[model samples]
Target: MRLFLPLVITFICGIVMILHFFIPHRPISTIGDGLTDWYMIVASAAIFLGAANLVQVHVHRINTKARNWKYSPVVLIGFIAMMATGLLWGVEETLPFDYMFQTMIVPMGATMFSLLAFFVASAAFRAFRASNWRATLLLASAFIVMLGRVPIGGMIWKQIPIISEWMMQVPNMAGQRAVMIGAALGVVATSLRMIFGIERSYLGGAD
Candidate 1:
């Protein structure tokens, strides 16, 4: 009964959404809009559930004194502090919430990204090694693109920038479009499977 009901609901909602895109009739459109409103309410409730789950997990870890449990308090403290500030002072500009976000959160985010740059450089170095013809071509393309972005590459060879631009506009764009098309097809397939009750994995057991 549990799985059957959800599958029925999924089929109905999926058909309504598909019709909403194609038909645009008054009755279908009204039902689609109502479904969308219900989706928003469910999503809002899920956010609260997720927050509660996070707090519960961290509190359990702190209470059990699990490995690296000391860090859990930091997560809890940050979550509580942000919530308190936003609820008490509001998130408007020049308020405590905004001040903390700009001064503390933004800098921390920047620092994390700065640290990630080194990891990316390390990965790029490994990936750019000319172990094969394909790797050699990749290394060369990367070298040209990197150099083209700098002043020295133009000073050394004016054509470097032009080649880099062509590579990005031609091959890179083609690859991106291919990926997007594949992803769109995959989404369509998955949605159809779910609508027809063939994708039973969502019910908890194997499909």
Candidate 2:
């Protein structure tokens, strides 16, 4: 019964959603839109569940006087400060809470992305290793494209920009379109299998 119910619902819901793309009737179209909006609302509620879980795990460690209990107070305080600010003020504008979040959260998020610069540089170095003809060609193309995008490269070699643009528009776009088509087919296949109960990874591991 646990497995049976979800499969039935998935089949019904996926079919209804796909049909909505073609159906033009106002009532059916509205039902489709309403269901999609309800999905977003449901997702919003789950955000609380995630926050509750975080507090539960961290608070338990703090209560038990775990090794890093010192950090828990900071976490709790930060949470409370933001919550108080947002609850008292509003998210629509530069309320104190929103401002704090914008300044602090945005920079921290940006720093996280900045961390990727190092990894990408490292990966590019590793990815360019010329072990084979194909690898050598790819590395050469990547170097040309990267340099072509920069002003120094344009000054050094005026022809690279044209070469890179042709590669990007022709071969790269063709490969991207092929991959997208394959991905679409793969998604449809997986969804259909799930709807038919052929896939059950959602159910936990064996007992």
- Model 2, 1-207: lDDT tens digits are 777777788777877787789996887688789889989999999999989987897899899999989998888888888888888886766689879988999899999999999999999888899999999999999988888888887798899888888888899999999999999999999888776677777765122
Give the poorly placed runs of model 1, Cα more than 4 Å off: none
- Maximum-lDDT candidate: 1
TM-score of 2: 0.86
Q: Where does candidate 1 have its weakest 10-residue lDDT segment?
A: 198-207
- lDDT, model 2: 0.86
Count: clashes, candidate 1: 0
Clashes of each: 0, 0
**Which residue pairs does candidate 2 place in steric collision?**
none
Q: Tell me the spans in candidate 2 whose CA falls farther than 4 Å from its real position.
A: 66-69, 91-94, 204-207
What lDDT would each prediction earn against the true structure? 0.94, 0.86
